[model samples]
Target: MGERLIVIEHEAEAGLGCFAGRLEAAGVEAEVVRPYKGEPVPGRAPAGLLVLGGAAAAWDDEGYGWLPATRDLIARAVDEGVPTLGICLGAQLMTMACGGTVERGDAGLEIGLGEIEPLPEAAADPLLSALPSGPVRAIQYHYDAMTTLPEGAVRLATGARYANQAYRLGDRAWAVQFHPEATPEIFASWTGGGDLPPERAGELNAQVEAAGDELRRTWGKFAEAFAAQLTRR
Candidate 1:
């Protein structure tokens, strides 16, 4: 049977966009599982688990009651040796699952573009090591951030406001605060109000125009990273 990629989508339109497309381009079967819609509980594990970015917090109120259970699902996936990746809210959930705490960070609203600095030890990480120096121009959209690092997790990358931008737990599980898969639709839907300056509209428009190409190149790196985990199997 072909390998399966488990994706837990939290929001209505916050599903993986370019990330999913890139996986398909690589001939990898990517299956999206909508847990919030009462989809099947992520069972039997999978080759990997990708938690997409979302506005909803993992620890939200009764509106998202399935969140706590989703944590169990992610932990189970990790326990089963399935490489997992959590983005944005997914990253926070992963941190909490790994015994880390997530609280309202003082970073305030981290929107628009941002820079990330990889830790020294990250040069040895399988996935992170593949990345080069200098800042990776990725779209950052999040109100909450991780306050503590998860046990056995090394900080892969950090930014000015978000210290825990990227992290790796054990050998396979990973989480990133920024959205590498943020397409124009995803970006626009998540953005609003005077939170971000309106002057960035032109810049945002350009990014949207080049979304296809950007997604291809960026997701290529992500797929390469994920593929490394499968090779170890």
Candidate 2:
């Protein structure tokens, strides 16, 4: 297998942040394709595939013309047993592609540093098992949630607001509703656009900054585990 991983970057601000460093450190090369910027999304992944989060909703095919193609790419990856990781919007897209559901969260926007409770199934998961035992924390910045997982999808972790925090579809595809790739700086940029009230955004950013070390350790290991998967292929 090639050392390259195909990465779908939905927007400029949402590009791979901390996770890019982790992949590089693990000796994995990432080729970022920005469909929003007019770059064509590849139909196949030579080694692995990573679909990053975005501001657009999973169902915004009309608004974002490239979404249909992206979803098609995800379906092909899972069908072919390619190592695939979907984050936030990417996760929702995976759900829709695999006959599941995603909708605007009834509980409202789940933005900030949140704890994820790994289910019993996670103990045996190849990727989530990399997280340290006990409660795991990661960045959360999404309005939509995966209400239902795809058929045969194994739920790995859950949160108070959203039950489908993480899941594994097929043998090689994994999806997470949270943004493990976001750094405090990248998160601050996301909130800087007035998505949340100024004070609330400040509070969330502070929380993320305070938990920087733990986020790095937890999500960094997760990234490394994914990189290991690419190598094994």
Candidate 3:
């Protein structure tokens, strides 16, 4: 059988939309496992590990019974040199598992479409090296922040509000605070009927709509690069 990318879905709404398609297009099979729906967290890491975003905070292990196991799975993948990608909550889990800290963002919730500034180190990084210079636009929706990165983790991307927007752990493990897998429709499902004011929500919608093409162009390359890395392994 072809190599499989294990996708840990924390929530039903936060499915692997664009990422799944891009990975499949690159000849990688994505096998989704919903731990939230009573699916067991794989004890062993697969060829590739993809942990999607979630509404729960990383420290909410008691609330989300599966978080602790998922975190361990991420740690094992990184330790064993598996190509791993974590988004939002997934990023937090990866960070925490790797001796980093996850805490609430005192700057409040960072929602809506925003630009992430890639650090100088990203110029030669494997996954982020494919991105264009200047601020990379991405969808953001998270209340938690990775306060401290793991030992020797290279910080790749930053934002005006969040300093730790992306980082590379070990060799093949990557964790991003932004949501590259989120499309406009998926983002709408996140912020459409929330407590956000109608005007603010509309503005966010317009911003995402305007930047949709660019997001796909840039993040698509990033996703494909991830898949390419998996294939190389």
Candidate 4:
């Protein structure tokens, strides 16, 4: 069969967005699977897997009927060395699915554009190595944090608010707490339409727009590196 990246979208609002163009530019085809719309999770691993963000907690399998199956798929993908990228809630699921811990952050909500500092270990990491050594600005919108990583997982990046900003499992699997794929429009839609105060939403929207160029520059390379890893495998 031809190569493809299977994207599991948990919500209609949190679709592929900016990541779609980047993956396409890297010559990686994406097949979005909306599990929230009754799409069944795949039984077998694809060439690559991308689990996007969502509103539900990682352990809320009862609330999201497909989460258990999705978690199983993530575990299988990692075990099989499939190139997998899990963002936000996806990362929490990856952590929980593989014997890690996910909990509501005691630091309260970490929402808005923020910086991620790459750990020294990230210098040699396949996906993170391509990123600059300095703090990289990324979109952050999550209430939960990964208190513990999966067994044998390598912590790639860390932040002040949340230490577990990014990690790698096996060789190809990656889980990131921030949203590298989010665009300013998406951020605005999330903030402006949500319970965010009008002034707060406006401020974040401006920050997202201001940091747009840098975010794309850094995350575009990240997406390319991830695709390269999948190609090599």
Candidate 5:
């Protein structure tokens, strides 16, 4: 059926920069749509769905005034067995749809580069089978976290603040709480027009580069696993 991947990004500039390219290398066409500005959510046609991280939250989707229907559509896509990779807010939304809990973390922010320990279950899933065993580098930028996992979901990766940094539902559906595909260009876009300070920019850039390195080291494992799952029985 010539499958494709739809990336539900929150902002135009902050879409799947490196992740899209990786998907292309894996023989999948990737398209991006920002729902925060009323971008249309496509139906059950994509080979997979990769929802991106954003400055917004699962609760703040209503504040953006463009998430309810979008999330519903994502939920439907996952139920129909579209390979899904939810990052940050997208991850939180998946949790909400699968009947989990999303709450502001009292543990403060997950800023800059952080570590993720892949669970044993992750080693068994097609989405994470060949991925790094533990403590992979990831870009972190949120204060909210998913406290509960969705029904029938298996925790894939975790860290100090969030124990469920990554999850999988069956072999085809997956969600990663961190940005495994964040690239330098995408990182620049997200940091655009912000008065955050030059020093912080350097720090953030370093973190982004570190995240990219981790992906470079590990995405082939994930890509192979995912594509194999797509062609599975």
Candidate 6:
């Protein structure tokens, strides 16, 4: 009802944070379906789709029973020209669903604030065209990387470690490795489980906090652009 976008949330903590508010403010209602909590994923996205990030590897269908269905939904959305945005693990899933490859990065885990530079191709992109020309920092918290892109995907952005940072499949579907929706608190919660050293975690959290205004300004535009896509559809 009233311009809804189906959001596939992979985990509890990975739920829509800032993007939720941004979408609402842009007049796009987000209907989040949490597969990690046994919520069934729909077979299609009638209006649009937003697949959030998670800790699970993209190929671990056996581990995440709903992943196969989720992949199917992503493929269907892309095939039907639905507006879709996938972040982090969602990006990995989109890559794999569209005949790309996602593997554990040989460069190790890419966590914390990272720089992502928009490519020349992004200048014509609907979602990324408004991004700053130079490198912009975003919250990065993922181990697996998209090693190869889908056959027809347009590479939108790149980073130092991971070459495939952002890409657009078909016309409306997009996938980005960085976390545009992560707030400082949400990122802190992610690092709170002692996965990283205390000092490192604190440092990363501080960096995110310091960059809050910039992150909101940059990524909030990205989210609003996506919301506009949904509303237009």
Global lDDT of each model? 0.75, 0.93, 0.92, 0.90, 0.72, 0.93
Q: In terms of lDDT, which candidate is stronger, 4 or 5?
A: 4
Put down candidate 5 lDDT per residue, 113-210, tens digits, no spaces.
77788887776676776775666776677789899888898888889877888888765678788776666666666555574677887788776765
Compared with the true structure, the alpha-carbon lDDT of candidate 1 equals: 0.75
lDDT of 5: 0.72
For model 4, what is the error of residue 23's alpha carbon versus the real structure, in angstroms, after optimal superposition? 1.1
For candidate 5, give the lDDT of residue 29: 67
The local distance difference test score of model 6 is 0.93
- Per-residue lDDT for 15-72 in model 6, tens only? 8988988999999988999888889999989899999999899999889999999999
TM-score of candidate 2 on Cα atoms, chains taken together: 0.98
lDDT of 6 at 12: 86
lDDT of 3 by residue, 87-203 (tens): 999999999999999999988899988889999999999999999888888999999999999999999999999999999998899999999999888888888667698888889
> Candidate 5: misplaced stretches above 4 Å?
43-46, 191-197, 210-212, 231-233
RMSD score of candidate 2 (Å): 1.1
lDDT of 1 by residue, 15-127 (tens): 77776655665555667878778886565456778887777776784777768877887888777778888989889888888789888778687876566688887788877
Worst 10 residues of 4 by lDDT: 224-233
On lDDT, the stronger of 1 and 5 is 1
TM-score of each: 0.87, 0.98, 0.97, 0.97, 0.87, 0.98
The clash numbers for all candidates, in the given order, read: 0, 0, 0, 0, 1, 0
Cα RMSD to native, each candidate? Answer: 2.6, 1.1, 1.0, 1.2, 2.4, 0.8
In model 2, the runs with Cα more than 4 Å from the true position are none
Please say which candidate is ahead in lDDT: 3 or 6. Answer: 6
Q: Who is ahead in TM-score, 2 or 5?
A: 2
Q: What is candidate 4's lDDT per residue for 1-233, written digit by digit as tens?
A: 33599999999889887777878877788888998889999976669999999889999989999999989999999998889999999999999999999999989899899989999989999889988878888999999999989889999999999999999998889999999999888888889666798999999999999988888888888888987876776
TM-score, candidate 5, is 0.87
- Candidate 4, which segments miss by more than 4 Å at Cα? none
